[model samples]
Target: MSDQHLLLLSILTPFAGAIGIVLLRQRPNLREAVTLLSATLVCIIVVTIFMRFDNAGLMAVDIAEPLPGLKIRFEIESLGMLFALVASMLWLITSIYAIGYMRQHKEKNQTRFYAMFAIAIGSTLGIAFAGNLITLFLWYELLTISTYPLVAHAGNKKARHGARTYLGILLGTSIGLLLLAILITYNVAGTLDFQQGGILAGKLDPAWSGLLYALFIFGIGKAAVMPFHRWLPAAMVAPTPVSALLHAVAVVKAGVFTVLKVTIYIFGTDFITSSGANDWLIWFAGATILLASLIAMIQDNLKMRLAYSTISQLSYIVLGALLATNTSLLGAALHISMHAFAKITLFFAAGAILVAAHKTDISDMGGLGRAMPITFGAFLIGSLSIIGLPPFGGMWSKWYLGMGMVETGQWLLLSVLLASSLLNIAYLLPIPARAFFGKAPDGTTHHRIKEAPPSCLVAMTITSLACVLLFFYPDPFYELAMDIGGTK
Candidate 1:
C-alpha cells in the first residue's frame, strides 16, 4: 500500500472506531475493545510512516482544491511526522489508561467518552499530516469540537461552563485572529502550502509582520499564552484521561506545534529573527512561563496545579519558536516529545492517586505515598523530568533551549528558563514530597490506600520509564529536529 493510502487510513481508523463504539454501546467491554484495537492499528500505521520518513516529504496527497489555487492536502514532514507518532502512540496508552479510569470511577456516558476520544484522535492525525494552512485550520477547529463533549462529560454546571470556555476561546481565536491571519497570508503569498524555508519571506513587509505574528500566536489559543490560558485551568473539571489528552497528547501540543510550524514553514525562522517579527513573542512567552509557574505554586488542587504547570511548560516551546535560532527550533521540536512523555506520566499518576486515595488536594496527600508508592514514585520521576533535571528526557530540550538563548545572547530568556525550572520544582516536587515525607492532616493515622488499578499502573509506569529511556536514547528526536532545520 502507498504511504498516501496509509496516511488516509490513519485518519479514518479512529473515526471508524468511534462508530464501532457507538454500535456496541450496550456492550461496554466490546466498545472498549474497539477503542483499544483501533488505537493499536493507528499506532502501527503511524509508526510505519515514521520508519519510512525521509527528508523529502512523503505521502503528499492533494485531495481537493477548495477554491482556485487553494488546495486541501496532506503530507508528512519531519516535524509533523514526529507529532503524529506521539499522538497516535499515546492514543493507545491513553485508551488503556482511560478504560481503567472510567471503569474504576464508573463515569457516566462512557460510550460518548470513548467515541469522542476516537474522533479527537482522528482530528489530531489530520493536524499532524496537514500540508497547508487551510487543512491545518480545519483540523484544528474539528479537534476543538470533538473534545468539547469530553470536557463536559460530567454534565454538571461546572463541566458545562468549562466546555463553553474551551469552545469559546478556541473557536473565537481561530475564527477571529487565526482565520484573519490565514486570509492575509494567502492574499500576500497567493498560496497556503507549507514550504521548507517559508512561503512568506519575500512577500510580507517587515513593518507589518509583527502584527501578523501576533495574530498567529494568540490565535492558536491552545498554546495557552496568558490572557488566553484560562481555558486550560477551567477545563480541569474534566476527568483525568481527558486532562492527559488536553495537556500532553493532543490539545496543548497542537497549539505549540502550530506555533513552531508557522515559525519554520510559514514565516521562515531567519526572516522572523532578522525582521524582528518575533520580538513580542519572545517577551510574551517568557512572561507566560514565569507567571504561570508562580501561579502554579499557589494552587492546592492537584490537577489545577498540573494545568498551570502545563501552561508554563508550553511557553518553553513557544519561546523556542520565537527564538528562531536553529538550536532553539531543535529544542522546540525535542520538547514536543519529551514533555509529552513526562507530563502524561504526571497526569496518569494524578489520576491514579485520585482513584486509589480519593485525594485531590496536596494538603491531604501527606504520607499517602507510603501506601501507593508506585504512583508517587512515577510522579517523582515526572516531576524531575519537568524540572529539566539530568537523567530525564526533558533536560536535553532545556539544554538546547538554553544553548539557543546563549547563541542568540538572550540571557534574560535564559534566566527565565532557569527560574521556571526552579518554580517547576517548587510546585511539582511538593506533591510527591508531601505524599512520601509530610504528615497527614489532623495527626491521625489513615487506612492504607492501595495503588490504582493494574491498567492505570501499567500506563503510568510505561510513561515514567519512557522519560528515562528518552534521556538515554535522545538521538531519534535530535535527528528528527535536525531534519526539520535541514541540518541533517
Candidate 2:
C-alpha cells in the first residue's frame, strides 16, 4: 500500500478491530484474540511507515475539504512518526499485559474495556498522523472520550472519580484552552496546516505570540505540566494497562507531541527564541521536572511513584522544547520513545507485583526478587533505563538533554537535569533494591510468594529487554530526531 493509505489504516484498523471483537464478544477468547491481533496489525503498519518513510519528504494527505479554506487531513512528520511508533509498538505489549491482568483479576466489563482501548488507540493514531490542527483536535477529543470507558471500567466509586478527573481536565483544557488556541491560529494564520519552521513565527508580534504560546501549552494538558498533572495520578485507579496507555503509549505522549509540534510547527523555534515568548516555559518545565521527582520520591505506592516519575520525565521533553535547540528537541523526541519502554516496563512490573503478592507499597516488596526474579529483574532494567544509566535507552535522551543544556548555555538547567536524574534513581532504584537486597517484611511468610502469572512476566521481560536493545540500536529514532534538528 501507499504510505498515506498505510497511514490511514494505521489510524482506523484499531477501531475496525474493536467492531470485530464486539461482534464476537460471546467468545472471550476470540474477542481477545481480535484485540491482540489488531494491536499487532496497527504496530506493523506504523513500523512500515517508519521503515519506508522518506525522512526528507513530508508524508502528507488531504483526506477531504471541510470548509471554504479548511480541510480534514493527516501526515506522518518527524514528531508524529515518533509518537506513532511508540503508541503502535506499545499497544501490542500492553494488550498482552492487559489480557493477563484483566483475566487474572477477573475484571468485569472487559469487552467494553477492550473496545474503548481499541478506539483510544485509533484516536492516538489519528493524532500521530494528523496533518493539521483541526485533525489533531478532533482526534485528541476523541481520545479523551474513548478512554473514558476504560477509566470508568471498574464501575466503582473510585473508578468513577478517576474517570471524572480524567474527562474533566482533558475536556476542560481542550474546550477552554485548546480550542481557543486553534481559533486564534485560524484567525491569525488564516490556515491551520502544520508547516516546517512553523506558521506563526513572524505572523504576530511578541505580545500576541506569548499569549498564543500560553494557550497552546495549557490547552494540551495531557503533557501533565504541573497544575494539569493531577489527572494522571488520579486516573491511575484504572487497570495497569490503562495507566500504561496514559503514561507511555497515548495520552501523555500526545500532549507533549502537540507541544513539540506547536514548538516546531506553530511557533518556529527561531521565532520563539527571538521573541523570547517561551522563556517562562523553561522555569515552568524545570519546576515540574524537579517537583514531580520530589513527589515521586515520597510516593509509597508503586504505581503512584511511577505516575509521578512519568510526570517529571514528561516535563524533561517540554523543557527541551522550550530550550529550542536542535539537541534539546532531538532529546525530547527520543524521550517519547525511550520513556515508553522504560515506564511501561515499570508499570507492568507494578501490576504484576499487585497481582502476585497483593501488594502496592514499596515497603511491602522486600525480598520479592527471590520469588519473582523475572519481574523484579525487568523492573531493575527499567530502573536503569529511567536512571539514564549505560546500556539502557534512557541514557541517550539524558545525554542529548545534557548536551541541549550545554548548547543553550543554560547552566542552571544542567543542575536541574542532574538533580532530576538523581531523583529518578532515588525513586526507581528502591523498588529493585528492596526486592533484591532487603529481607521480607516481618512475619510476612516469604514461603508463600512466587512470580506473577507467566503472561505478565513474559510481557514485562520483553519490554525490559527492549530497554537495553534501544540503547544499543537507537539509530531508527536517532536518525528521525537528527532529521528534526538538522544536527546530522
Candidate 3:
C-alpha cells in the first residue's frame, strides 16, 4: 500500500476494531482476539509508515479540505513517526498485558473496556499524524473523550470523580487556552499548517509572544505541568491497563508530543531563542520537575508514586522544549520514547504485583521480591532506567538535556536534573530493596505470593529488556530525534 494509504489504515484500524469488539461482546475470547489482532496490525502499519518517512523523506497527505483553505490532513515527519511508532507498538504490548490483567482481576464490563481501549489507540494515531493545529486539536479532544469511559469504567463514585477531573482539566485547557491561541495565530498568520521553522515567525510581535507561548504550553495539559496535573493522579482509579495506556501509550505521550510539536513546528526553536520567549517557562518546567519528584517520593501506593513520577518525568521533556536548543529538543523527543518504555515497564510490574500478590501499598509489600523475583527484578530495571543511570535508555536523554543546559549556560537547571535523579532513586529503588530485604507487614510467615500470570510477565519482561536494549541500540530513536531537531 502507498504511504498515504498506510497512514489512513493506521488511524482507522483501531476504530474499526472497536466496532468489531462491541460486536463480539458476548464472546470474551473472540473479543480479546479482535483486540490483539487489531493492535498487532496497527503496529505493523505504523512501522511501515516510519520506514516510508526515512525512504521517501517526510510526506504529508491531505485527507480533506472541509472549508476553503481549512484542511484536515495527515502528515508523516520524524517526530510524528516516532510518537506514532511508540503508541502503536505499546498498544499491542498493553493488549497482551490487559488480557491477563482483566481476567486475573475479574473486571466487569470487559467488552466496554476493550472497545474504548481500541478507540483510544485510534485517537492517538490521529494525534500522531495530525498535519496542523486544527487536525491535532480535533484528535486531542477525541483522545480525551475516548479515554473517559476507560477512566470511568468502574462506574463507582471514585471512578466518576476521576473521569470528571480528567475531562474538566483537559477540555478546559484546550478550549480555554489552546483554542484561543490557535485563533490568535490564525488572526496573525492566517495559516495553521505545521511549517518547517514556524508559522508565527516574524508575524506576531515579540511583545505578545510570551503570552502566546504560555497559552500553547499550558493548553496541552497532558504534559501535566502542575496545577493541571491533578487529573493524572486521580485517573489512577482506572484499571492498570488503562493506567498503562494513559502513562505510556496514549494520553501523556500525546501531551508531550504536542509540546514538542508546537515548540518546534509552531514557534521555531531559533525564534523562541532569539526573542527569549521561553525564559520564564523554562523555570516553570524546572519547578514542575523537582516538585513532582518530591511528591513521588512520599506516595505509599505504587501506581500513585508512578503517576507522580510520570508528572516529574514529563516535565523533563517540557524543560527540554523550553530550553530551545537543538540538543535539548533532541533530548525532549528522545525522552518521549525512553520514558515510555521505562514507565510502562514500571506500571506493568505494578500491575503484576497487584495481580499476583494482591498488594498496592509499598508499606504492605515487604519481601515481595522473595516470592515474585522476576517482577521485582523488572521493577528494579525500570527504576534504574528512570534514574538515568548507565546502560539504560533514560541516561542518554538526560545526557543530551545536560548538554543543552551547558550549551545554554543554564547551570541551575542542570542542578535540577541532578536533584531529580537523586529523588528518583530515593523513591523508586527502595520499593524493590524493601521487597527483597524487608519483612511482610503481617509479621508472620507468608506463603501466598507468586509471580503474575504468564501474559503480564511476558509484557513486563519485554519492556524491561527494551529499557536496556535502548541504551545499546539507540540509533533509530536518535536518528528520528536528530531529524526533528534538524541536527547533524
Candidate 4:
C-alpha cells in the first residue's frame, strides 16, 4: 500500500501480465482480457502516483546497489510522472486498438505480439521511473529487446531486416555512446543519480562538456537525430500498433524524455547555457527537424511518412532541451504529451486504412475517405494538431517553443520551427485531404471500403478528441512541465 511498493508494482504489473498472457495463450479472449486488465491496472497505479506526487511525500525505492554508490533505484518526479502517465494511459488505448487490429488483420503469433507488447510497456515504465543512470540504462535496453519481436512479428525478410536495424542502432548507440557517456559522467561527478539542477555543473569542464553532451545526444539514438535516424524508418515494416508504440506511447518518447532528463537533471540548463555546451549541438536538432520533415513529404507509404514525421517531431523536444531555457523545456515537456496523442491518432488512422481499404500508398488512397469518413476525420484532426494549428493540443507546445527561441534570440532556429510547421502542413494534411477530395487511381468510387473495426474506431476517436481537449485544457501537462523547471 506504500508509494514505494506502488512504484515497484508499476514496473512489474505489465511483466506479470505478460506471464498471464502466455499462460492463457490458447484462449485468445482470456489473453486479451489479461492485456486489457494489466493496462488498466497500470493506468490506475500511475494516476495514483500522480495524485500523490504533490501530497503524499513518496520516497524513492532502491531495488539494488549493484556497485558501491551505484544503485538501481526508482523515483517519481514531475517529468517522470508525465512520461509514465502518457505511457500507461496510452498502453490501455493501444491495447484496445491492437485487439481490433491484430484480430482483423489476422496476425499470426497474436499471443507473442501481446506478450512482447506488455514487456515493452514494462520496460518503458522502468525508464520513466528510473532514479539513476544505471536503472535507466537497464530499462532502456530492455525496451529495445522487448520491442524487437514485435517489429519482426511478420517473420518476413522485410520485418527481420527492419527489426535488425532497430536492434543494431539502438544497442550500438547506447553501448557505444550512451554507456560511455554514463561512465564518463560517473567518473567526473562520482554519482549517477538525477538531480534538479544537475550534478555535472561544477565537475565537468566547459571546454570538454560539448563532447560529453554530444555523446548523450547521439547516444540516445531513439531521439532519431539524423544519420542515426534510419532505424526509425526501417522499423516501419512493423505493424501499425507497433508503429504507434514506437512513435507515441513508448520508444521515441523515451528517447526525447531521456534527452530532456539529461539536460535538466544531468547537465543542468544553466550550466549548458552558461558553458555554451549545446551551441553546435543545437543545429543537429534543428536540422533533424527540418530535414526529416522534408523527407516525410517525399514518402508514399503512410506509415513511412509518419515515421519520418516522428523523427522530425522528436527533434522539437531535443531542440527544446538544447535551447536550455525554462520555457523551451516546458514546451518540450508539453510536446511529449501533445505529440503523443496527435501522432498516435494519425497512426491509428493509418492502421484503420490498412485494415479496411487495404491501402498503403497515399497515391492509392484518393477518395477512400468518402467510405471511411470517421477514420479520415480523425486523421484530419490529428494532422491539424501536428501542424500546431488552432483548436489542437500541439499548438500550445509549439507556441512555447517559439517563445523560447524569441527569449533566447535564436531567430534562425525560430525560422526552422516555422519552416518545419509549413513542411508538416505540406506532408500531413494532404493524406486526409486526398483521402476526402482527390480522385482514386482507377477513378472508381470506394463504395465497398468501410471503417476499421469498432475497437479501432473507439481508440482513434478517443485520441483525436484528446487532441482537441488538450488544446483547451493542457493544464495538467502544462503544470507538470512547469514543475520540472521549478516554476510551479
Candidate 5:
C-alpha cells in the first residue's frame, strides 16, 4: 500500500474494529476477537510506516479542505511516528489486558466498552498523524467524546460524575482556549499547517506571544497543569483498563504530545527561547510537577494515587517543551514512550490487585505480595522505572531533561526535576514495598489471593520487560527523539 493509503488505513482500522465489535456484540468471543484483530492490524500498519519513514522531513497526505486554505491532513514526522507507534502497540497490549480484566471483574457493558475503546484508539491515531492544527483539534475532540462512555462504564453515580468532569473540562478548554489559540495562529499566519521551524516566528509579534502561548498551554487541558488537572483524578472511577488507556496509551499522552508538537512545529524552539515567551510560563509546569507529586504522596486509594502521579509525570514533558532547548525537547519526546510503558505496567498491576485480592487502599495491601508475587514484582519494576532508576527506560528521559536544564542553567527547574523523582520514589516505591515487606492488616493472611488472569499477567509482563529493555536498547525511540531535537 502507498504511505498515504497506509496512513488513512491506520486511523480507519480501529473504527472498523469498533463496527465489527458492535455487530458481534452478542457473541462475546467474536467481539473480542475483532478487537484484538484490529489492534494487531494497527500495530503492523504503524510499524510498516515507521520502516518506510524518511526522517529528512515530513510526509503528508491531505484528506480534505474544509475551508479555503484549511485542510484536514495527516503527516508522519519523528515525533508523531513515536506517538503513533506507542499508542498502536499499547492498544494491542491493553486489549489483551482488558479481556482479562473485564471478564474476571464482570464489568457491565462489556461490548460497549470494547467498541468505545476501539473508537478512542482510532481518534488517538488521528491526533498522532494530524498534519495541521485544525486536523489535530478535530481528532482531539473526537478522542474526548469517544472515551466518555469508557470513563462512565460503571454506570454508577461516581462514574457518571467523573465522566462529566472528564467531558466538561476537555471540551471547555479546547473550545474556550485551544480553539481561540488556533484561530489566533490562523489569523496571524494565514495557515495552520505545522512547520519544522514554526510559521508564527516572523508573523506574530514576540511581545504578545506569551499571552497567545498561555492560551495553547492551559487550553490543551489534558497536559493536566493544575487546577485543570482535576478531571484526570476525577476520571479514576473508570475501569482499570480505561485508566491505563487514559494515562498510558492515549488521553494524557495526546495532551503532552500536542504540547511538544506545538513547541517544535507550531512555536519553534528557537523562537520560544529568543522571544522569551515561556520564561514565566515554565514555572506552571514546574509547579504542576512538584505539587502533583506531593499530592500523589498523600493519596490512599491506589488508582487515585496513580492518577495524581500521571498528572505530575505529564508536566515533566510540558516543562521540557517550555524550556525549548533541543535537549529538553528530546527528553520531552523520549518521556512520551518511557512513561507510557512504565505507567501502564503500574496501572496493569493495580488492576491485577483489584481482580485477585479486591484491594484498593494501600493500607490494606501489606504482605499481599507474598500471595501474588508476580503482580507485585511487576509493580516493583514499574515503580523503579518511574523513579528513574537504573536498568529501566524512564532513566534515559529524566537524564536528558536534567541535561537540558543544565545546558540552559535553569538550576531551579533542575531542582524541581530532581525533587519530583524523590517524590516519585516516596509515593510509587512504597506500594510494592509495603506489598512485600509490610505486615498484612489485622494479621490477616493473603494466601488465598492469587495473581490476576493469564492474559493480564501476559500484558503486564510485556510492558514490565519493555521498561528494562528500553534501558538497554532505547533505539528507534531514542533515534526518533533525537531527530526532533535536531541533535541527530
Candidate 6:
C-alpha cells in the first residue's frame, strides 16, 4: 500500500477500533481484545512505514481545504517518523500494561477507556505526520478532546477536577496563544506551511519576532512550560495507564514535539539565534527544569512525582530546541524517543506496584523490591536512563543535550543540565531505592507483595528492555531525528 494510505490508516485504525469497542461494549473481553489487536496492528503499520521510508524523500497526502489556505494533510518526514515510532511502540506496552492494571484495579468504563485510548493514539499519529500548521492545529485539538474522557474515566470528584484543569489549560492556550500565532504567521507570511530554515527568516521585524516566539511557545500547551504545568500535575488523578498515556505515550510528547517542530520548521534555528528570541527561551526551559525537579522532590504520591518529572524532562527538549545548535537540536529530538521509553517504563512499574500492593506513596513501598524484584529492577534501569546514566537508552539523549550546552558555550546552561541531572537522581532513583532498601516504620513483616499481574510484568519488561536496546542501537532513530529538521 502507498505510505500515504498507510499514514491515513494509522490515524483511522484507532478510531475504527473505538467505534468497534463501543459496538462490542457488551462483550468486555472482546472489546479489550479488539483494543489489543488494533493497537498491535497500528504499531506494525508504523514500523512498516518506517522501514519502507525512503529516508531522503517526503511522503505526503492532502485533502481538500476546509477554507482558503487551510487543509487536512499528513506526510512522512524524519521527525514525524520518530514521533510515530514512539507513539506506536508505546501503545503496545501500554495496552499490555492496561490489561493488567484495569483488571486488577477493577476500573469502571473499561470499554470506554480502551476506546478513548485508541482514538487518542490515532490523533497523536495525526499530529505527528501533520504537514502544516492548519493540519497540526486540527489534530492537536482532536487529541485534547479525545483524551478528556480518559482523564475523567474514574468519574470521581478528583477526576472531574483534573479533567477541568486539563481541558481548560489546553483549550485556553490553543485558542488564546496558538490560534493567534497561526493567524499572525499567515497574516505576515501569507502561508502557514512549515519549512526548514523557516519561512519567516529575515521577514519578521526582529523586535516583533520575540512576540511570535512567545505565542508559539505558550500556545502549544502540551510543552507544559511552567505556569502551564499545573494541568499536568492536576491530571494525575487519572488511572495509571491513562497517566502513562499522558506522560509517556501521546499527550505531553505531542506538546514538546510541536514546539521542536515550530522552532526548526517555522522559525529556523539561525534566525532564532540571530534574533535573540531564544535567549529568553533558554531561561524559561532552565527555570522549568529546576523548578519542576524541586516540586517533584516534595510530591509524596508516586504518580504525581512522575508527572513533575515529566515536566522537568520535557524542558530538556525545550532547552535543546532553544539552544538552536545542531547538536542541541538533535539532542532535543533524541530526548523525545529516549524519554518516551524510559518514562513509560517507569509508569508501567508504578502501575504494577499499585495494582499488586494497593499503594501509591513512596514511603509505602518498603521492601517491595524483595517481592517485585523484576519490576523494581526494571524500574531502577528506567530510572538510570532518565538520570542519563550508562547502559540504558536515556544516556545518549542527555549526552547530546549536554554536548549542545557545551556547543553553545553557555556555562549557566551547562550548570543547569548538571544540576537537573542530579535532581533527576534525587527524585527518581529514590523510589526504587526506597522500595528495596527502606524498612517499614512499624517493623511489620510484609513479604507477600509479589510482582504485579503477568501482563503488567510483561509490558514493563518489554519497555525496559527496549531502553537498553536503544542505548546500543539508537542510530536508526538518530538518523531520522537529524534528518527531520535537516539540521545535520
Which ten-residue region of model 6 has the weakest summed lDDT?
A: 440-449
Where in model 2 is the C-alpha error above 4 Å? Answer: none
**lDDT for residue 479 in candidate 4, whole number 0-100:** 87
Per-residue alpha-carbon lDDT of candidate 6 for residues 243-353, written as tens digits (9 for 90 to 100): 886656599989998998889888889899999888786788899999999999999889999999999999899888888888988889999999999999899888888
Query: Roughly what TM-score does model 2 have, to 2 decimal places?
Result: 0.98
Candidate 1: tens digits of C-alpha lDDT, residues 125-226: 999999999999999999999999999989999999999998899889999999999999999999998987899998899988999999999999999998
For candidate 2, the 10 contiguous residues with the lowest summed lDDT are 440-449
In the predicted model 6, the residue pairs found to clash are: none
Q: Candidate 1: minimum summed lDDT over ten consecutive residues — where? A: 442-451
Predictions in order: lDDT: 0.91, 0.88, 0.91, 0.93, 0.93, 0.88
Q: How many clashes (backbone atoms < 3 Å, residues ≥3 apart in a chain or on different chains) does model 3 have?
A: 0
lDDT (Cα) of model 3: 0.91
Clashes by residue pair, model 3: none
Candidate 5 lDDT over residue span 244-264, tens digit each: 976665999999999999888
Q: Model 3 over residues 52-108: C-alpha lDDT tens digits?
A: 677246677897888678699888888888898889888999999999999999999
Tell me how far the alpha carbon of residue 247 in candidate 3 is from the true structure, in angstroms, after superposition.
2.2
Task: Say which prediction, candidate 1 or candidate 2, comes out ahead on TM-score.
Answer: 1
User: Tens-digit lDDT track for model 4 on 188-231?
Assistant: 99999998899999999999999999999999998989879999
* Candidate 6 overall lDDT versus native: 0.88
- TM values, all candidates: 0.99, 0.98, 0.99, 0.99, 0.99, 0.98
Model 4 pairs whose backbones collide = none
Model 1: residue 125 alpha-carbon error in angstroms: 0.8
